[model samples]
Structure formats: structure tokens, C-alpha cells
Target: MASERDYFHLSGPLHLTHVKWDNLYHRKSVAASLVQGVYVQEKDRQEQRKGPNALAFPWWAFFHFQLLHTLVDDVDNSIFGAIYEFKPPPSKCNDTLHKTPRYVIAFRGTIKKPDSISRDIELDLQFIRNGLHQTSRSNIAIEAVRNMVASVGGSNLWLAGHSLGSCMTLLAGKDMAKNGILIESFLFNPPYASAPIERIRSKKLKHRLRIASSVVKAGLAIAMKDKKSSSFDSLSAWIPCLFVNPSDYICSEYVGYFEHRRKMEEIGAGSIEKVATQNSVISLMMSAFGKESEPLHLIPSATLAVNFTPSRNFKEAHGIHQWWKPDLCLQSKLYKY
Candidate 1:
């Protein structure tokens, strides 16, 4: 099992930028400049830790081959997504240690707009069992990632996203893995495929809907297992790590489902198992139905439940302040894990 410190360290690199969907296009120039600054700072920061026994950051995985590309929807030429590729460095420990460039693809969270990525998230939630519609923004993100990978000779990949982007990260990872690409995905406060039923306003309706949702979720889980596709859920190397605030309704609370816990454990993500349990209504239903279940996303390799110090502002903690805090403009120390 991993402690909070391990998660904090693993989370260091991703903290380079705050991820939000629509804001991604609008803040491109600023984010690029910020990444450059972080690159320089990282070099100096690593040098300070240099000693015979000191661990080093994967600079080659992040800075040396840093290439940012913008993707657009072919239909309307709307900004589809942005991806960062890190071409493998020539050598590290020894001259012969070859490496493949790792791609860091991020998706943005939902925005309250009629024509934004949030709409796609809602659609994904509506059809959690089937996943996003082909023309949904989430699916478009998958196409963008696939195209980027193909252009680079189909190298190994890494993924990170915030909020709805986090959900997109899972979908893209699965699609890429099905195509024979290995990946490591990191998600920050990822939501369940379906929206929370706590807001339904009627307990009876909520319970019935929960049962309905559970049946649909279980059926989909069984179907996926039957297909035996090379989705991320079925890949050994496709490790995923999730970071969430303890009180986050979208992720933290939802992990209670037996299916969600089973998915995490199946991937050997023992770190998250501590916080997850088998008591959720969905898990109970799956057992009663005699169907094995799995989560909407791959079980993470590790789950970091962060409880920010000093202040526990719900919205603030739920955001990716662990990386970059836009409201405070504060950046934490970067670590190489």
C-alpha cells in the first residue's frame, strides 16, 4: 500500500498545469509559457538534490522531448484537444538504456456552457454502459489521442486529466490499449460514469434509479468481460493512479461500490482499497444478479486521497490545487517520482 507521501510524490509532475476543457484552448499560450518556466525550475531543483544516493526526476520523460500539439475536430475545425509528447531521451543510466517517448494527454473538466465539453460528459453519463457517443467530445478526444500516437510510430503513452478530462483519460486509455498501445494513466478527481443520484430529491426514486443504474452497470461489466477486448481494464501494464479529495462526491464517495473496489484490486491497486468497500447498493445488486462487476474506469494502480492542510474548502480541495492553484497562484514543489 502507498502512503499519502507516495501519492504526493507521484503527483508532483502532473501538478505542472491545471486542466480544464474549454479553458485549455483559451489558455494555451499562458500554459506553454508556464511549462517552460517549470522546465527551467525543475532542472535547478533536481540539481539541488544531486548526491550519489539521491533519486532523480524523469527529465527525459518530461522536458527533453517536450512537444505540444493541438488537435481540432475535423467536422467544424473546432479545437478538439491538446496533447504533450515527450520523446525518449537517448540514454539515462547507461548509453544502451533505450526508451520510448511518453505522451501526456490531458482533457478538461466540465464547463457550464451549452456547447462545451460538459455536454459530452453528460452524454457519457447518460449512456455510462455504452460510453460516450461516437461524435461526443469524449470520443473526439480518443480520436485525437489515437492520431497523435500514430504519428509518433505508436509509442508507449501516459495520460492525465482533471474532472471530466479525468474520465476522458480512462476512455482514451482503453481505446489506445485496444490498439496495442501500453499506457500509464493518472486521474485527478475523476467522476463516475453516471451523475450522482443524491440530487434526485426523492429517496424512493433515488433507490429505484440506483437499482436501475446498477443493473445497467453490471450488464455492461459482464459484457466487457465476455468480449475480452484489450481494454485498459484487461491490461497488466496499463497502470492508472487516481488523486482525489476525501470529500469529493464525484470520486471519493463513489469508490464505495464493490465493483469499483474490485476493479482497483484486480489491478493490484492496494492503496485505494483501504478507502473503498463492498457496501454500496450497486455492488449488492451485482452479487444478487450473479454478475461480476467492474468500475467505469480501470482500477487505479494507486488512489491518493488528499486532505489539504489548513483549509478544507470543498470546491478548492476538489479542484487540482494539489498541482496548480489558479485562485491562489501558488505552485508546490515538484518531485521526480
Candidate 2:
């Protein structure tokens, strides 16, 4: 697999110092840059065999942010996430937007390198099984997020992650949101652990399949009604920004997910859709087998941004680099409760 550096060259100096923090594109660029920084830091650890050096820290500086902490997986000693404190220049300090976060926590996705691949893949499997929250690395992340929120408050912090790391941030963000703490979040190419129904070319056939799936899921949800919780409804007020590419099968399901809900509502099946959307087939199956699980992809609300620009391949489609590009063709919509 090609490294992030191979996909997008960052050897040259970055020119984002003057970008406004309140702008949507710039916020995405900054979030993606921070996540990329974690990837570079991991690569540096693997190549240097010593630890991450000064070179691995340049990504944050480009956005006028100082690295505050690195969240490492104890088993692999890989850099999976980092906390950054915004430190604008004296001239730009007063101009910074009030909504700008004082601190941002960003997480990197899977790296296929020998140093981190094993643990990263393990987390991926756990994610698929909806058991990621049971992992030690996840516990570590939750603790870090909890401590940060307690210290700085949720409004002053932001959460950003890509791919598997997006799953991590989603879990953390959901956990915090459940406790009435709403943090700004950016999720890039977050994995949706289900069939790639969005990739089906036949819209009619796809809609039929979705309706069938919804019926089954809704039935299962009703069957387990005694175990149901309205806690997830509380998350309706916390809307995260979800960046997805239609060509990226990993995250493309989100497009269909939101669209399916709208379709169901149009047909007056909104009640069934509500139960179906809250529960997934896999999660219901797990529950039947006496395994408690929460589908990681289920969210109450999001600002879903779909990239319409063509991708050369799956790598390009799913890459974090695309979000920072200036010429992206995107269609964004706010999906609320």
C-alpha cells in the first residue's frame, strides 16, 4: 500500500497560516492535516526506530497549532492520535473565530506498516464486531478524551479522525454526547460495517433491498423492545461533520443510509425506519446470541458532505488528503433529527 506521503507530497512548506478557522474548507483542511501528522509521526517511529522526531511535528505548525500530547497504543507503541493546542500568531489571535477550538484531538487511520499493522487490524476487526469499545486502546482514547473535556470543556475542543480512527472518535464523541457534552467533530471516510449497498447500480433494486433490510431490522428491534434504550435519541442535538466519497465503499454507505431514511419517510414508513435506523442487522444478531453491541455507524445527526469529484482508485477515493485539496467538488447537507 502507498503511504500518505506517496499519495500527497507534503515535503514542501504548507501555506495555510492565513486561512480562516471559521471557514468550512479550512476547518476540514486543519483537521485532516492534524490526522496526517499522526500518520507521519508513526512512520517516523518505524523508520527512525528511536521515536518521532521534530520532522514528524511539522504538520501542526503549518496550521498554527502546537502538539500537546500523543496517544500511543501500548502494545505496538504506535502513534494513533494526538492532541493539539491552537496557537495563532499575535496578529491573527484577535481575528480567530470564537467557534475555533482551543484544543483539537485528531486520530489517524490504519497504517499497513509492520510496526502498527497488527494492532491496527485487530482494532478494525473489533470495530466490525462492534467490540471496539472493549479494547484497551479504545479505553485509553476514552480516558484521554474525558480528561481533555473535563479540563477544557467540550465546546473548546474538537475531535477529528479518519477510517478506523474515525471509529474511535465516533465512539468517544458519542460517549461524550450521551453525557450531555457536545464537541465539534470531523469524521473522514469513516467505515460503515455493512454491505456496500450504495455501490449497487440498480437504484430500484437497491431501494428494494434497503426496504427489505429495514423491515427485518425493525422487526428484530421490536422483538427486543424490552432491551431498547432511548439514550441514543439524546445524540440528536450533537451533529458531527461526516466527509464521504461515493466511490469509497468503506464510507459510502452513509450516503444511502441518510437517503434511505428520507425515502422511508416519503412512503410513510418513517416509524419503521426509525427503529431500523437505530438498530443494525448485525447488532440485532449479536444481541440474539447474548452479546451486547452497539453499531458504531449509527448516528442521530450529521452534516454529511459527499465528494463528487472522481477518484482514480479506491485509495484515492478513501484518502484523507482529498479533504484538504482546494478544488474539491462537494455536495453538503445537514441531516438533523
Candidate 3:
């Protein structure tokens, strides 16, 4: 039988052990690895019945972090997220290179397996309906994050997740930001519920459609001024790091989401763009039906990082494994509200 280490493709003797603590790439790699660890933990649980000592920590050794807690889905009893406490070597304890977070809460995305697929897909659908926060899994994750923040404070705590898990992180981070607790967060391939306008082939047609959509959304915002409010404005300063691939339609819209805002500014429609970006059409429709929903994709600020490197397929493009790779062609820009 293959060992758990064989399952981890990125972490081993050849992994990023030499990278300093303050290296941005290293931090990204560590966050991705920790999230992957949650996947391995779940796999261990599934296989534990086969033999003794089946549980494993595949990525822990490479990053010098210990699993402090695992956030399990109450319905399926499967692991979804984990809290890792950094355990640097004694030799490097006094070095200023220890600027990294003392604790990190990383969430894993959907795992397509018989043991966890149902719950994962259910949460994915809830994500589409903007009802993910109402699930018990979300409640558990938010409580875990909140307790961690209260235990150690937010200054040295970090939140990270990929895909559906990224949605959880965004919601949790937003909740914390709303209460004046700003924690560093990294979101990879987070799904945007809006249409995939970025997939359109014609640049001119795409631009025109975006402009029309923005105008309509802006008009609706003005017409519903009394009913709607900019609750996200307070989160303007808490910018999470968003990692996206242009080839991945689930997340690629974010590339245009931020870019379109800039174009709106260039055309002197900054005020319209502000209102339109804060409120999505789905949220407006829900309000019409007397249903309150918060669009999980909308955010006031983010440090958007787009991968320019061409991917082989959607799976390769959307995989969390790519974020930990050292030689990635990426373009990063900070969009501030």
C-alpha cells in the first residue's frame, strides 16, 4: 500500500524548507499545504478501518506546523478545516524571520468521494443560493474561527481556503471584519455566483455587456436606495488576498470584477460602479421576494493575483496544488475601496 507521504505531491525532501518566514511565496505555499493536510486527514479517517496507525500528517513536517484542531462537518463527520500552530525550530526562534502567523485556520474545498461528496455538493449548492452561512458546517467553521481569534487575538492569526472552502473563509473573515477584527486571509479559486462573462471570446462584446450590466445595476441601486445600504463599506480596509486563474471560469470573473471597477472609474462612473459592485443582481432579486441573502462573492477590497500561465485544463487550473508551486507566472494588483 502507498504511504500517506506518497499522496502529498508537493511536500517532501524537495519542498520549501529553505524559504524564509517573511517570504510571500513561502506563506502562500504553507497555507496551501495546510489546507491539503485537511484533505489528507479526511482520507486517513476513511482508511483507518483498514489498518492500525492509518492516520497521518502528510504536510506537517515540511512546514514545521502542528495540527492544533480539525474542524469536522457535523453532518458527515468529515474534516473540512484545520487549525495549525507554527512550531519553528529552536535555532530560528530568536531570528526576526518568525514574522509568520502563529496560528492558521485553513479550509479544504469539495472532496469528490463517497464519504464526503453529498455534504460537499450540498454546501456548494447552498453557496449558489447564498445560503451557505445558514448551514451547520458554516456555523461550526465560524465559531471555530471566532474562538481562535478570541484565544490568540487576530494579529497573528491567518485564514485560508480553496474553492468552496474559500467561500467559508470569506464569510468568516467578513463577519470578523464587520466586528472590527481584521485577520489576514487568502482565498484560492473562490467561486463567483455571477455569470462567467470572462469566458466570452469577443473582447468588445464583453466590454459592452459589462457596461450595460453595470449601468442597470447602478440604476437599480438608486431606485432601491431606501431599502439597500452599503454594509460592506466598513470592510474597505480589510483586503483579502485572492488567487485566481483566468482559465478557471468559477473564479475568473473576479479578474473582470475588479478590472471593470477600474474602467468604470476611467469613464467617470465611479459612483455607479461603487453601488453596483456592492450589490449584486441576485441579492436584489432575493430582496424582491422578501428573502434576505448576502452575495458571498461581493467584496469591497482585495489584493487580486491572476495567474497568467496557461493551464492544461479546468481541473489543473482550479486545483489548489498550483498555488504552492514556486515558479508561477502571476500578476498581482491591490484594489482598494
Best by TM-score: 2
lDDT of 1 at 48: 45
Top model number, lDDT: 2
Query: Which digits, one per residue and each the tens of the lDDT, describe model 1 over residues 168-284?
Result: 677777666556675656567777544555434675775565455545544554543433233323444454555555456666543333333454456665333322321223443
The lowest-lDDT stretch of 10 consecutive residues in candidate 1 is 328-337
**Which has the better lDDT: candidate 2, or candidate 3?**
2
* Residue 330 local lDDT, model 1: 22
Please count the clashing residue pairs in each candidate, in the order shown: 2, 0, 0
- Give per-residue CA lDDT, model 2, range 159-260, as digits (tens): 999999899899999999999999999999999999999999999999999999999999988987725547778888899999999999999999999999
TM-score, cand. 3 vs. native: 0.94
**Against the true structure, candidate 1 has what lDDT?**
0.46
Q: Per-prediction TM-score, please?
A: 0.51, 0.95, 0.94
